[model samples]
Target: MKPQAHPTLILWVLASLLMLAGCASPSLEDYRNRQPVLVPDQFFTGELSARGVVKDFSGEVIRTFDADISASWTDEGVGTLDEVFRFDDGEVQTRTWTLTPVAEGYRAEAGDVVEPGLMQWQGNAIHMNYVLRVPYGDGTLDVRMDDWMYLVTPDTLINETTMSKWGIDVGEIVLVIQKK
Candidate 1:
């Protein structure tokens, strides 16, 4: 008689496949070359407000915060975004992003950014990949971050950030920013 595959093994294989399929990550190449209607310098100009949450690898919410931001075009295609962040635990911090137009798209520099960040957009989504120096204990952790921004409307933008360390998923940040 021919040997048969065990039922439990078959079920495990199916479950693993389903989980992998459901966990597919977003790719910029999926939307490349499609002209996105996003004008970052224009859409982010004036006053803005944002609310966001930080979640751990298992998707448990770790923290939440809000922010008030001011954005303006500085000179030529260069822009500045000033943000003041207030955390739920009563901690506050500030970050400034200097955005300069580049040949590919834009280059962003900030205090915690290890290197100049690169940005690319297609369709309604903008992708920014960078290494962020996150405060950990007394020092800082250099984490790879993939930040994606989707324009929902003229005044509304939703951003999602995935953070990883050593090629392993660490956490995520989800934010909704709106023009004021």
Candidate 2:
């Protein structure tokens, strides 16, 4: 039998790499100078809930989560992460944080439930990079997530998460929020 060639598979691999490369954000200062999202200081206040399902590479539903989050803004343009509760994996995890705004966006240090991470604002989006402490003999793992917040209205924001776990590219989570 002759050798078979698969151009489609090669094309798909190339396309995936291109998509990943597209996420390389420019410098924070210059990027922010252009068409910024211009979020208000008090944007994170009030009660918010996001519901979504997580899918794998094969487009299979892996897990579902409902995240309840609350925030308070301060005079220093600080977005204080008041609380976060996630219901998923047949378990509920609650996390509390204190956020301080740096040059770009905010840095949240979690007291419980989740590990601490840095969140930066780019235009209409917020990016999250953190280390996940997986429960295993394996050590901690690093993750980079781009969380984009799109405002459907003044009180509604949709959230999307595209992240890599342990330096390996996973899938993403898209959640729509409703304020309470």
Q: Best candidate, lDDT-wise?
A: 1
Clashes of each: 0, 0
Off by over 4 Å in 2: 1-40, 84-89, 111-118, 134-142
lDDT, model 2: 0.63
lDDT of 1 by residue, 35-70 (tens): 446678778899999999999999999999999999
Candidate 2 lDDT by residue in tens digits, 5-97 = 699988999889877886775444544543436363545676777788776656677878888878677677666655454647676666666
How well does candidate 2 score on lDDT at residue 78?
A: 63
- Look at candidate 2 and tell me the lDDT of residue 33: 45
